[model samples]
Target: MKNFVFSEAVVMAGLRWTIVLIFMLFGLAKFAEYEAAGVAKIAAHYPLFAWMYPLWGESGASNVIGTIELLTGAMIAVGAFSARASFVGGLMGIFTFCVTLSFALGAPAFWEAGYGAPFLGSTGQFLVKDAVLLAACFAIMVDGLRRHTAP
Candidate 1:
């Protein structure tokens, strides 16, 4: 029984850290524009976002996305308000997933041209990673709520 409890605790801790690391790396990459050129190269291939580049410009979009990433990462890392952070993160993940899905589905012509094929790869990666992160956030929220209300 004791060993089982310890194992569960360890798993929980690992899950928490995994979520934190995901957010941290995501924020850092965005902030540094670590692969901005590559991302822009992919985006350029997409017809949907062709207008976005002209509207916001790559630098502006990067800055905005970076800010959101940093804030979300910090909120999760602090963990002081775990429930709130988890809720926010989960919602953000859902929103991101939806947006990426839309781009993936709506830009077939771009893909057919071969210019946007790389974006499909990147979007697939984002969907997988975000889905896992969303699950983690939901678990954290449920666990935190249960603990708070436990008799």
Candidate 2:
């Protein structure tokens, strides 16, 4: 009806699709050697994923991360039809960001001066952007829950 012409649902749908597009494209890009190597530089610093460096190198580690990204994107895209998919998508979004966010702990370059200032260096600036995406994912998850539980 007229009420549906301009609505929150439409906005939520747009946000959902945006996440899908970004995640999928980045996932696909990880397959490239250059891109993977770039990630490897960072993953190398990360304790949990750094093992990828020894076990499979940048390419191998990237492939693993890429696969997960692709799956999360697909699930978010499919949130239009299934609440369960949205829930999974949201959880994945949170998981991915949490790991990336953790980089703030070990990566000194992210901190300005000696880790006391609010301002960040280039790497910190880069990683900080994920906080926004993490929030977006949380929003999507909540939206999905609202729709699913609505009477």
Q: Which lDDT values do the candidates have, in the order given? A: 0.58, 0.85
For candidate 1, write residues 1-151 as lDDT tens digits. Answer: 5665556446666776777677667656754555555456556556755666777777655556566666765655544356556556545644544554555554434343455555444445544455566667666656555545668
Q: What residue runs in model 1 are displaced by over 4 Å at the alpha carbon?
A: 1-9, 41-52, 107-126, 147-151
Which 10 successive residues of model 1 have the least lDDT summed? 104-113
Q: How high is each candidate's TM-score? A: 0.63, 0.88
Return the clash pairs for model 1, or none. none
Candidate 1 accuracy as lDDT: 0.58
lDDT of 2 at 50: 81
Residue-level lDDT tens digits of model 2 in 24-56? 998999899988987887887777888877888
For candidate 1, the per-residue lDDT at 32 reads 56
Roughly what TM-score does model 1 have, to 2 decimal places? 0.63
Candidate 1 residue 112 Cα shift, in angstroms, is 12
